[model samples]
Target: MASDVHRRIFDVVARIPAGRVATYGQVARLAGLGGQARLVGYALHMADRPLPWHRVINARGEISSRGDSFSETLQYRLLAAEGLVFDEQGRIPLDRFRWDGEEAPAGPAGEGS
Candidate 1:
């Protein structure tokens, strides 16, 4: 069974929209598990659901190396399909594509008015 922390991580990742990306640290912080970047990555690595996992990158706006050997290229292709443009050095332009962690306006209990 997925731990609570992992579930939190997945929830945060699931909210990342197309054409935007969140860094590992960003997802960890957003999930209320501050500084647990590695935990976010591990949760994503094990996720079986179809998440926008490709939208999670490193703080440097780049994909982190993976031992699986296929993820890097696949991630790049996935992001590319979303119209995200990478620099010549293969890094997403964080200022352009990075997900700004903004919450929409809400009413009581954090629900939309």
Candidate 2:
């Protein structure tokens, strides 16, 4: 069973719209788990449900290396499909594509308002 923490993390991740991305730290903060960026990554790694996982990246606007070349390649392709352009250094331009959560459709989990 998914813990409340993981559930909350997933809920926040679900709100990340396509064509925009969130950093692990951003998702962590939005989920009411501020400063728990690594936890956000762990929750995502353990997620069984279908999530826009590729929409989450590192603080450097680059995909975190998973050591699985296929997954890394897949992540790049997935983001590209959503119209995200990576620079020659493989960094997504967070300034242009990062989701600020201002247009959030719903509140993050565990928040009343």
Candidate 3:
């Protein structure tokens, strides 16, 4: 079975749609993992290479790389290519583009709120 942390992280990451972003803390809360925001970061750090690590960012919408310039640059490039606009400071505008994970309605707008 997948470890609780792994499952939580994966579930959160899966919910994040393309062209949007979610903070690690937001992911932790959505995953029902209490306030273990750092745990989400740790899990992502240990994730497989194929995982979309670049899609997750700090609460301020800044890339989390403290070193490894290549990885950081790659993250920026990938996000930019996905239509995610970044400021001159290299931070994404979270409020304007945050992904709330709400899917489109299956029918007309009158069917649901």
TM-score of each: 0.86, 0.89, 0.82
| Residue 103 in candidate 1, Cα distance off native in Å | 5.9
Taking the candidates one at a time, how many backbone clashes does each contain? 0, 0, 0
In model 3, where do residues sit more than 4 Å from their true spots? Answer: 103-113
Q: Which stretches of candidate 2 lie over 4 Å from their true place?
A: 103-113
Q: Which candidate has the top score in TM-score?
A: 2
lDDT values, one for every candidate: 0.86, 0.91, 0.79
List, residue by residue over 58-91, the lDDT tens digit for candidate 3: 9988999758999899988988888999999989
- Look at candidate 1 and tell me the lDDT of residue 112: 29
9-104 per-residue lDDT for model 2 (tens digits): 999898888789999999999999999999999999999799999999999999999999999999999999989999999999999999987654
* TM-score computed on alpha carbons, candidate 2: 0.89
lDDT of 2 at 102: 64
RMSD of each: 4.8, 5.4, 4.6
Please provide, for model 1 over 1-113, each residue's C-alpha lDDT reduced to its tens digit, 9 standing for 90 to 100.
78888888888888776778999999999999998899898898788677879989999999899866688889989999989999988899999988877643465787622
